[model samples]
Target: MTGNGGGAGPARLGWLDALRGVAALVVVFDHSSATLLADFRRELMPEFNTSRFGIMVFFLVSGYIVPASLERRGCVRTFWIGRVFRVYPLWAVVVATVLGLGLCGVVEIRDFGGQSAVTVAVAHVTMLQELLGTPSLLLVLWTLSYEMAFYLLVVALFTVRLHRRSATIAVTLAVLAAASVAAGAALPASALSDRVGTGPLILVGASVMVVAICCASATSPVLRLFGGVLGALPALVLVPFNGTVPLWEGLVILAVMFLGTAVHRAEHGQGTWWRAAGTAVVVVGCAVGSAYRYGDGELFTRRGWIAAFLAAVLTFGAGLAWRRRQLPLPLTGLGTISYSVYLVHPVLLAVIDGTVGRARRDDPALEAAFFAVLLPLCVLTHRWVEVPGQAWGRRLASGPRRKPVGGPERPLLPFRRPCERTRRWYP
Candidate 1:
């Protein structure tokens, strides 16, 4: 996920940058451990799923900042444009790099199972491949599916003017998660794909997404509303029935994000602290209870998942409470490159694993070396790839000097730019 904003200058949101940096490192460690810290990984994973911990933090960060970005822009067309540029360029680069490496025999990509090249390509293009029954070429990409779903749902809520109902939405999703478990809604991964065939589902999903995005971006009010509602339908359908993760956890992920929005609302005076607090209580309780009831997965223990979930929430709360404090440059810099680190590390690891092979034992030295290598590369990618793309996005989203005949695009709500005294709140 992206940190506060596009530019990597003096970060106004140092706390968030620090959090993103911390989460990225944890995720890197989680993946790197498979090769470098095998012995300790066995000991660590059962007590703490570092992957879950890191992703939950990322999701929270995205939840907090992404909607703010959209609302700040106050135009669906520009919001989509910004999101496209912010996400896709780097994604395209990474995907192509992986494919190139695979072709060169430098890294063996994940098998796409029985899916054809056309299907896999289209699914990945949609960024909902994980939910569309296509195995991600890069394992880490699975989280992006949920991130995309969150984006869709956010747009839907914003279009409908229900965005302020963050607390209610969070509570509803959490309750649904709990209810899913209680009702024994145990669907296998990709159940929809299994029934309808992966090709058909992918085609339909991609078509709907295209229509939804196009219509939402259209100037017509009716089209925007229809598109918003239509866009949300796929996510609402897929996350519950077709995700690789269990149904309850998919619902919980969305709940966690909206809970972040609730906190944002509370801090900005659009909502009350007690409402945010109560929403958190319901979300955390339901998430923990759902995990406990769902029992241990093959990779993670119930206790570990519960612990990680609580830790992520607490970490976010701590970040928010300490948002006013100045943070170290190094930490914020890491966060600036956090998205690059998240996407690039997997490919790096793949190359290393393919060529050098996994370490024979818990080699802390090797792990340290991997980070030493990874960080510099990620910093370079961040500067060269992410910064330029975001700049272009910002330029495009700001739009042409000549205004259209329709007058200025509709504001999501009349938002006065925060005065200097209130700048920190915006950050």
Candidate 2:
């Protein structure tokens, strides 16, 4: 979730920023604990599942803001342009750094399990490598696959005039998720890869994604609609079959995201509070039910999953309650650089794991030291990398808007009655 800040608009939502900051730290802890606090992590993971908790909060924030961004811009081309610039520059830099490290033997990269470099590169370029059965260079990038899927779905709903039905969409996805669990598994892991072959699926999915984004951003309405649907079809096909996660949980992820959108709609007077509340209940219930039915996986406990899911919902609700109030600058500042924090910490952790190795026992001091180094680096990256990239996006999007006589030039995305409550918060 990001906006063109060069467009004069409403005050930023500090609460969302605070939430992102909190989630980023939690995610950092979730990963760092493995190396620095292994014993404590073992004790806590089966009960809390910190990773799920952190990611769900992020998905909620993304749900709350992303559609509003598209609606604000009212031009698919500019929206796509904003998204590419917001995400890719830092991502490219990070990937290059990882490759460089791998080359120089500073850190080892993940084995792609027989995937050709060309196929892996194509899948990663689409950012759907996780779904297409290509291993992520950075393990955290699996979540981005889903985030990209969500973006396509959001654009599809928007183009079809169904964006306002967030509550209904949330409930429907939840119900489908519950049903998937009840019906038993439809496919094994990487089902699409098994059927179509991983390399071919990667090529096809990547091609579709590129075409969809380009066509959706086109000026023609028919192309836009076709592109939106084209983008959505891979997600619809992959989540229930080829996903790395269980079918039900993958669906639940989408449901939770729509649930966040419903909350945003309620906040902005586009929908009633009751609708949002009801959607939350249904989505949460279905998610819990699915977890119970699916039982525990090899790596995660059902109890942990259920607890984390519930806690994430409660945490989001708490944030929404305080949305109108000012948040502390430290928290908001952390949120402002949360994206860098999320992406960079893993690279740092990889370097640490490779060089220093894990502690023989739980070491809180080492974890603290990791953060002390990581946060300042994130601040620097956010300032130099993200800010400049986004500014370039704004300039690209705002190409030559007309000025009125003796007045300021209009924004590229003309202002509709803005929804102050729906300010974009990047993941």
Candidate 3:
């Protein structure tokens, strides 16, 4: 997102915006169909949740974009301050609103408890609710938990003199990842239980992959070639996933991260083909996933053919837009606000489900219409409540001397004045 030349502001990757918006919509559709597509949304949306895909897009984008932001500002302290401000404040609003709505009978509460409330309070405020456990207010927040982990790792990477020595970081990460895999293999049954799980192993793999990509960028020849392939190899493996979906889901997320790194390394205004290919794969992946989840198993069958057609059509549409440099503003805006939107919207829909709606199962049209209404309400919430609160948080984080985005908007990630000498040094 940063430009090292002439103090230019970071550029938003248009395709990522497009991806976020699409992911949000897919999640919305999945939730909306909870009333209509009982086999799909409620019973198996997790199995088929492109929401996770959206989250992957988000985390990967965060991993790349936030670093770019750090480069622009040239300080980790400011970077963390801004990142925290961006996520948490708006999240606080969501928690309070959901709890308030539930307590007032505006929404229904499930598993409400002191522990539930307190745990979520502590975990979310720290941005660890997803990592530590499930969220109390909303179900979609686990992605944020992993995202926060990645952010922490990035901070560590930048702080340890590792960024300046990409090769060392790569070697360290690679060794750790290999050791983790071995440890997972060697762990006693007691440690391998669901309670203990493979999180360390997964994280290790991720760390190695990140270092390798960064190292490849700095080097060339064999490492670069292998790293280049890895960059989107994860995505290619996972996006069009089917069969035993949960395992593949985890793999898909890793893929999204690799792909995101690839996106970050791309020169500004370069690789129209990469964006086209990536977006197209995601759309097609969703379609194939939908078919796999709800349709007959045979690929040559009518339903399978239809799924292929749907995916192909989506691919064509995305490709056309990518080629034309035409982007959907609403989608991009949703993408911008999407992490908040995804986290908050499901709780809102859950309320609607428990209300007069009563989770209608007979009518796809009515359910779809409900989403039409609910998603916008969530967006309105993003605009009025979440956005403003985040602004305040950023202001608190950045402090005075920074300009507000609007008359009343606040800054996050405050920076010390950059002397001309500092700018010259980086460039």
Strongest candidate by TM-score:
1
Candidate with the larger TM-score of 1 and 2: 1
Model 2 accuracy (lDDT, Cα): 0.83
Give lDDT for model 1: 0.86
TM-score of each: 0.93, 0.92, 0.60
Clashes of 3: 3
Query: What does candidate 2 score on TM?
Result: 0.92
RMSD (Cα, Å) for all candidates, in order, is 4.3, 4.7, 10.9
Model 3 scores worst on lDDT over the 10 consecutive residues at: 1-10
- lDDT of each residue in 1-427, candidate 3, tens digit only: 1101112321335555665666667666666566556655544443344444444445445543565555565544445556655666667677788878878887776662334344445545545444333233576655654455445444444433233232233233323333333333222222221243334323433544465445433323344344434533322321212111333233333334433433444433323545535543553354345334333445443353343234424432453347337577776666666665576667767676767765445576776676667667767767776667556655654554544233643223332223111121111
Candidate 1: RMSD to truth = 4.3
Cα lDDT tens digits for candidate 1, 148-232 = 9999998888888787788999899999999999888989999999999999999999999999999987766788889999999
Residue 197 in model 3: lDDT: 33
Candidates 2 and 3 compared: the better one by lDDT is 2
Give the C-alpha miss distance for residue 345 in model 2, angstroms: 0.6
